[model samples]
Target: MEWQVWLSIAGITLSTFLARSTLLVAGSRLRLPPRVESALRFAPACALAAIVLPDLAYVQGVLQFDLHNARLLAGVVATVFFALTRSMTGTIGLGMCAYWALRYLAGP
Candidate 1:
């Protein structure tokens, strides 16, 4: 719609492309130290926790860990599913179902 918007879009696109390309190019030739490689194995789980924990544990700008917090309860159930079955689909489906069931049971 405007020159500034176009420029901003271009800048973001170029930056993203460069950043990802750098990672790909370097990944082909670079060998991480053994210690670093081992540590990197946890990166995915750490990142997932970083993203999901907030939504699971917080509500309306407050931390909620009580029985009324459906998300917390569902997250625990999903974690158990993952631990036992290692199934992503089962985790998500069961977690959402658990959350909805709890929410309904907690009725207004």
Candidate 2:
């Protein structure tokens, strides 16, 4: 709609492309320390937890840790189910079912 907005978007796209391409172009020559390589393996899981944990722990900008919090309850159930069965699909299915059941049972 505006020249400034288009310029900003173009700048961002160019910067992002250059940053990502630099990594791939030099990745073969780049060497990371064993410790850093090992630590980087956890980055994905840490990033996922950083995103998902907050949503499961908070509701409407408020921290909820009680039984009435269906999300929190379902998260716990899912965690236990994962620990026991180690099935990603089953954990997700059970978690959704648990959340829905809790909400339905609690009523509107």
Candidate 3:
């Protein structure tokens, strides 16, 4: 609502756009060694794990492992599906469906 807040938002938007676009533009022209290219491929997997690990390990303000925790089970199933199918959208859809089905069958 204030001028400072609006300025801060605009600054952040411009910075983020520049940061991402710079990488996209540079990546096409940049050539790396084979080892570096191979290593860079793991970045996405590590980042995805970092983001997903917390959610899979936590639920309902508490951490517990039980059949009642359908999300954790569904995550495992989804991981296996991803490994086998190597499809992002399919894995996500199947994982979500598994979670909902387990939740429904187990009753809330």
Candidate 4:
């Protein structure tokens, strides 16, 4: 790799470290508003959905939302399972089982 690429990587690493650590280091002194804190509580779920939704919704570079899409169907099943049981472990297990079963049933 070129020296410029190495330097850029080092800079990015340092900046990311500082950005993340600053919050923890100054957390005791920082006071967020109640509304902001409440909103921040949902950030994890929002981030997760942003990352996972696209993968479940898209297949072969196309958007799919029908019964033919195994991932989408598995996600729906997992969602319902989670909603009914409130168990993260069960949700993941059932989701993977559903996905595998759907894929196997679809055949090649």
Cα lDDT listed for each candidate: 0.92, 0.94, 0.89, 0.96
Residue 45 in model 1: shift from native, Å?
Answer: 1.9
Candidate 4 residue runs with Cα over 4 Å from true position: 2-12, 26-35
On a 0 to 100 scale, what is the lDDT of residue 40 in model 4? 96
Choose the strongest candidate by TM-score: 2
TM of each candidate vs. truth: 0.70, 0.72, 0.60, 0.71
Indicate the residue-level lDDT of 2 in model 1: 100
Error of 3 at 88 (Å): 3.9
Model 2 C-alpha lDDT per residue in residues 15-91, reported as the tens digit of each score: 99998798798877999899998999899999899998889989899998788899999999999999999999999
The sequence of per-residue lDDT tens digits that candidate 3 reaches over residues 1-108 is 699999999999999989879878787677778999899989999989898877787797787677778889999999899999999999999999999999899874
Where does model 3 exceed 4 Å of error? Answer: 2-5, 18-41
Residue 103, candidate 1: alpha-carbon lDDT: 89
Show the lowest summed lDDT stretch of 10 residues, model 1: 23-32
* lDDT (Cα, tens digit) per residue for candidate 1, span 34-58: 9998999999999899999998889
Count of clashing residue pairs in every prediction: 0, 0, 0, 0
Top of the candidates by lDDT: 4
The segments of candidate 2 whose C-alpha lies over 4 angstroms from its true place after superposition are 1-21
Models sorted by lDDT, best on top: 4, 2, 1, 3
Global Cα lDDT for candidate 4:
0.96
Residue clash pairs of candidate 3: none
**lDDT at 46 for candidate 4?**
97
- The residue-by-residue lDDT of candidate 4 on 29-86, one tens digit each, is 9998999989998999999999999999999889998999999999999999999999
